[model samples]
Target: MAKTWFITGASKGFGREWAEAALERGDSVVGTARNPDDVQALVDQYPDTFLAIRLDVTDRAADVAAVQQAAEHFGRLDVVVNNAGFGHFGMVEELTEDEVRAQLETNFFGALWVTQAALPIMREQGSGHVVQVSSIGGISAFPTVGAYHASKWALEGLSQSLSQEVAGFGIHVTLVEPGGFSTDWSGPSSKHSEELDAYADVREAASKRPSASDPGKPEATRSAILKVVDAEQPPLRVFFGKAPLGIAERDYESRLATWREWQPVAEEAHGA
Candidate 1:
């Protein structure tokens, strides 16, 4: 029962790892990166199971073409992993219009565009799994990463609604909420806006705060994601990292408490 997968951002991080896992499971993958050559090394490792492709998920026209190419090459695509994303760290007030646009373009609208193109094929086949490599940033707020959080938050909402909309078509959508890992994320992929440097004193302190980059923390992310990829029926949300697990839980608890106390008000809003 081998399956075919189309995964974005396969050059590194969770994308590369997930591509490995999928191949290990005997699945064929069309692993995509901005520079398809970036994945040549991976392609060399698993020649038969992987196809490297260049993809900029933000380009709607090109994205549709990529999906069509995958479906044609693989004959059918069973899984779509939207893992291409980046972070923009800066206070909302400190960010520029261009920086905000770039943040949302890659993290939010890119996923949306890819999903829109992939849905037609999935609907035709009546089966597919769409995995979004999101972050805990989408679920909670933090200093300096407000712009990043906004993009992820938008993704969370879009993916959740997509899950409900595509359920009847046998398409499963899962959101992988990862905190951090031992990757080059802090490099260009996670950049700070220059305009925000005026608040450097405050932002510097925030940056020094504990993150998944701490020793031994990234391993937890690796293990958690592999677990999700192996699940027979993955949940709508798969939280990665020890810190994210706790953060997600607390967020859920507070949301539940609010719902409980305000059920009457909530119910009235919808006439429940």
Candidate 2:
């Protein structure tokens, strides 16, 4: 069956890769980007199967309208990929209030609004998939990217709850926790705050850590996503890279250990 996919931020990075893969598989796609022109090449290539639309996911009303329009145009939507977001790099103290708010608005609230719009359509049809693009930072924190981590963590929580609520309606939700890829996420797509000397040591240590930009490949991510889309029973949450997979495993283990270590203290608070 050829599914109709509605993907946000489809002009570049993982979003673009997903769109291309779908079209190659003879699926119909409604690709949304802030600048429609950015995705024109795809429209040109897959003239009958692809529709490029201009959209800013932050605008709730506009996003709803676009989703509705895409569904109407395709006659039905089988998948909704909320892949529209950017990375914000800076220590929490260094980032301004507006910067933090902007990060949350696009990364967390943007996905929320898109999900709200897509749910009714999916519920009516009784079948659809919603893919939320999060990051390893959603589960584990790192220096210099605190704001980005916070936004992804919020997204992770929202997608987890959404999966439970929509399962009865035959609507599936997948939270993709990708570590790093050879994309513009850390380069042209990311926003950086003014550096402060007070955090020099921490920043230096962070810089010494392995770079996310050169490790993962976008083609591999595209293939993994396609598999998830085609699965009869996809996982609620999946890690996309070796780094993310290992990080998540270690993080949960550490969390469990800490909880057990303090279990007595926690139980004593109840006065039992």
Candidate 3:
């Protein structure tokens, strides 16, 4: 079957790659960006199968309208990819209130609104997939990008609950957690906080971290995404690169050890 995809941030990076992959494989896509002109090339390339439109995902009403337009145009929406997000570089203390809110507005609330918009349609049709483009940062903490991590972590939690809630409606939700990808995420699309002299050492050490090396190719993930959306039972969470599993394993191991160590304390708190 030729599935229909509604992808946010389809102008560049993973969203563009995924949109092209689906269109190449004979699927239809309504690709949205803040500037529809940015994705005009894709529309020109796949004239029949691609529709490029303007959408700033942070606007809840705009999210609803875009999803409705997509469903109406294609007659169905089989996949909704919330891939429109950017990295915000700031220490926890260094982050501004407005910065945090803006980050959540796009990375967290944007996906929330889009998912809310699509759920009704998917439930009525009894089939759909919602792919959240989270990062390995969602699972682990880093020095300079705390806000980005918080956004992804919140997204992870939301999608986890959403997966269970929508399963009965034949909707599959997948969190695509990628490692460092060779994309504009940390480049043109990224925002940085005002550098503080006190955090210079922390910033320096973070920049030298081993995990920052060997960025995955953005185009390489196209096939993986294709298989995921095409699956009979897609995973609730999946990693797009090798780094995430090791990161998760280490993070979980440390978390489990700490939880077990505090088990007695936790139990004592329940005294009747």
Candidate 4:
């Protein structure tokens, strides 16, 4: 059976690639972007199978409306991809309150609203997939991108809980964490905080990281996404690029070591 997909940020990057992949494979897709014009080409290319919706994911009401409209148009939504978020580059101390709020509103709350909107429908249908576009930053912290990391980390925790909650309802939740995709996420689509002269050295070090210099091609992830959505038992978390696995391994090892080293201290807190 052909699946129906509602993908946010369908105008570019992984969203665009995944949407076109599904459409090309005879699936139905409702693609949303802030500007409908950005995705109009897809609508034109696949008139019957593609829908372009104007959506600002941060708008809670509009997100609900878009999800509802997708279900109505397609008769059912088989997949919901919350891929509409941008990277915020700022040192923790350099970030302003508004910048932080804007980062959280779009990257964290945006996905939350869409997931909430899609759940009832998926629950009623007894089957669906919700794919959250998280990042490698979700699990690890780095300089100059603290706000982005915070947003993704929040999403990571939320999706983890959501997966366990929704499993019995036959709704699958997956967090797609990519390691530096060759998208505008760190380029044109990225937001930056006002720089502090004190952090110049930190900024330089951050800019020279592997993620800044090398990024996987965005189009290469289409097939992987298709496989994930089509799987009978999809993973709760999946990494889209080569870098994430190594990063995860190193991070987890360090974390385990630290935790183990502090096990006595942690146990002492029980006052036993």
> Which segments of model 1 are wrong by more than 4 Å?
195-198, 212-230, 251-272
lDDT against true structure, model 1: 0.82
lDDT (tens digit, per residue) of candidate 1 on 1-272? 78898888988877887787778778899988999888898789888889988988888888888888989988998888888887777787878999898889988888888889899999999988888888888788778888888888999999999999999998988998877667766676887777544787887778776774452344345456556655677799876766787777888999999989999987789973
Clashing pairs in 4: none
List the candidate 3 regions with Cα displacement exceeding 4 Å: none
Please provide the root mean square deviation of candidate 2 (C-alpha atoms, Å): 1.1
Candidate 4: which stretches are off by over 4 Å?
A: none
Global local distance difference test of model 4: 0.94
CA shift of 179, model 1, Å: 1.6
Provide the global lDDT of candidate 3 against the true structure: 0.94
Residue pairs with clashing backbones, model 2:
none
Which wins on TM-score, candidate 2 or candidate 3?
Answer: 3
| CA lDDT for candidate 2 | 0.92
Over 171-252, each residue of candidate 3 has an lDDT whose tens digit, in order, gives 9999999998889998989999988899999999999977678889899999999999999999988998878899889999
The residue-level lDDT of candidate 3 at 70 comes to: 95
TM-score of 1: 0.87
- Residue 173 in model 2: lDDT: 93
Residues forming the 10-long window of minimal summed lDDT in candidate 4: 205-214
lDDT of each: 0.82, 0.92, 0.94, 0.94
- Considering only N, C-alpha and C atoms within 3 Å, which residue pairs clash in candidate 3? none
How many backbone clashes does every candidate have? 0, 0, 0, 0
Residue 124 error, candidate 2, Å: 0.3
